[model samples]
Target: LWGVELDPTSTDPRIPVVLSKFLRANPGDFKAAETSLRSILVWRANFDIPTLLTSEDFPEELGENIGVIRPKDVKGRPVVYHQYSGVDHKAAFGDLDRFVRWRVQLMELSMLQCDFLHADSLLMIHDYAGVSIFSYDRYAKAASKKTISILQDNYPECLAVKLFIHIPWWGTSIYKLVSRWIPEATRKKISIVSTAETLSVLLTYIKEDDLPKIYQ
Candidate 1:
């Protein structure tokens, strides 16, 4: 994997991190965990995820809008700020296949920020202010569902926590679209807040200095 050591006796702390991910994702089912690990390994190679980290094959502006933000959270974990409102969702997700690849590439970029030995997961921030029912159309929803499926199955346990902020009452449906993709265990790590309380709540996890200027 990705040049990181996986052997338990290799003296690399990342080895345990890798093993723990499988164990946590599969629980006590050693057989299922082995099966899943093999599947992810094959998926990673076929997906060419390693090259995605070095390639400039995707549009830079798209990354900004989807937000694989570089800023670390309060605990030094990588943070991703995905802005859902006031964005050109159609242009960003017009080609669902390409969009998913680009999204995965951005995710890889964020994951690289983690040392894995110390910070093995990411803090995800979702901003939904100014979003309307018509904004999150079919294309965006489809792209979201696809990306979530890929990450949950192939990546596994990379999301430490997620916060849905500045969400309007109508944005409940927006969350609902992808909520199914978040497993029950992962859902325990999420927080959803109204526009009025978003700032204070977000600041508790992400320092103001590290938070994006747009969110501030």
Candidate 2:
């Protein structure tokens, strides 16, 4: 079924794990997984599936309902863009390791789905995942590179991307896991924020300033 982390700060994005288990239990039937995931994506995108699935004449046939979502009554205001910063919930660092692995898995899926690549924007919410992949031991480096390639290829337009990485995963330390996946040209486009101070710097819309120290 579809899955989302109710607690953003949760260390594990367990939905992937559950999905994997289900896949193992029932081989080759991906329709259920896709349906569930697509439903979740529709919800996340704020699309009213019920309305799309129903009309006044077919009300009884509808399994859900849709209603007008009133617009916020703000008269003429600019919407400020905020960078993606994983999750805001407070949680232990170790707990996030599982999510890091799952993030890699999702990046791989983007290769087939291609929506993440074509979207107007892409927000990758990662706690320690982005950075931690760098430290996935030498054995997993090849697999990690493959995943990173998919991510690099699928970046959305406007190059609008945000990452929240922690600890030793920042800077050149991360090169090993993903360097091969991204071309030198594309690598120059990724901006990283590994510290609170760096986030403040991003808020100010400043670039080339001193970056914050990585936090584990």
The most accurate candidate by TM-score is 1
Candidate 2, residue 151: lDDT: 40
Q: CA lDDT of 139 in candidate 1?
A: 82
Where model 1 places Cα greater than 4 Å from the true spot, the runs are none
The sequence of per-residue lDDT tens digits that candidate 1 reaches over residues 167-186 is 88887776776797878888
lDDT of 2 by residue, 34-56 (tens): 56445545543453323332331
TM-score, structure 2 vs. true: 0.33
Q: Each model's C-alpha lDDT? A: 0.80, 0.35
State each candidate's clash count.
Answer: 0, 3
TM-score of 1: 0.92
